[model samples]
Target: MEYRPYKPVNLTAAGRDYAVAMVRRHRLLETFLVTTLGYSWDQVHDEADRLEHAASQTLIERIDALLGHPDRDPHGDPIPTVEGHTHRPAHAIRLADAAPDIYRIARVSDADPARLNRFSGHGLRPGQTVRVGEREAGELTISLPGNDQAPLVLAPEETKAIWVSPAASAGLRGPASI
Candidate 1:
């Protein structure tokens, strides 16, 4: 147990290993809570935080297996592999900055449960499709694919927490997004 100042970039080998293991446990717990226990994405972050430090490695592994080894957590954050590696998407951009075109909801932040609720109320989720409408007066409008639903309006800050990527034309032809 060494008392060293925190240096995120230049960690010692042992420090880095411990850091990675902790992060892996936290993420796996989040995935498991969401997938197996039906916890919403916004609810898992705090729950994982409380359990990660106390849960044993064996319990974490069992949970991972139960969830079929999910690669992403409920909010679409990558879960570190058993080897501590993470893969990030290359083209994800904030919905606020996305061009006025069709985009698929890639990820939403878990930092704000209220915002997550708002997104859920509008049927926004990862892999769901949305059309980027106009941005005006610090708000962004997005059209959801439904005959009866109106467009969803979000604040700029809320829009920034959402990531989207260009949806494939063929994928958009499905009944949900077409």
Candidate 2:
């Protein structure tokens, strides 16, 4: 968990609570901006980061209610509850690490907007069921559910930014389209 070399930090109970609160605020704001204010998935993260610092608990709760208590944000990240409990699927794995099988995208890293835009262009957003194919030279082959075109090859950086869970539990057995 160390982002810096030779630096280690652990969370105390209160510290954990604070961390969750900040995350909760961030995700809730992202949900609101996308679902209500018409922000694209690629546009909400930094906006949410800024808003999370200024939004009050009451405002976040109201946003949560307004969004009908969304379970996940535009990036497919689990939104923590007001109680600070979050549920990330146990089977969720980075796309690069996924076995060759059908999987529903669960989340994508929000660290880069350019990557997000590229993923969206390739139909790689959360809830999209994709088939993982061969791997070679740090790239993964991916195919959309019903596409007949050549498989899309995701580079290592893209795969590392994407996560997926098995498709059966996606609750999208008969999606209208991919």
Question: Number of the top candidate by TM-score?
Answer: 2
Worst 10 residues of 1 by lDDT: 169-178
lDDT of each candidate versus the true structure: 0.81, 0.87
Candidate 2 residues 29-63, lDDT tens each?
A: 99899889999889999899899999888998899
lDDT of 1 at 146: 64
Model 1, 105-130: lDDT tens digits are 87888889888888888788887788
Output the TM-score of candidate 2.
0.88
| Clashing residue pairs, backbone N/CA/C < 3 A, model 1 | none
Predict model 2's lDDT versus the native: 0.87
TM-score of 1: 0.86
What would the C-alpha RMSD of candidate 2 be, to one decimal place?
3.5
Model 1 regions more than 4 Å off: 1-9, 169-177
Error at 123, model 1, angstroms: 1.5
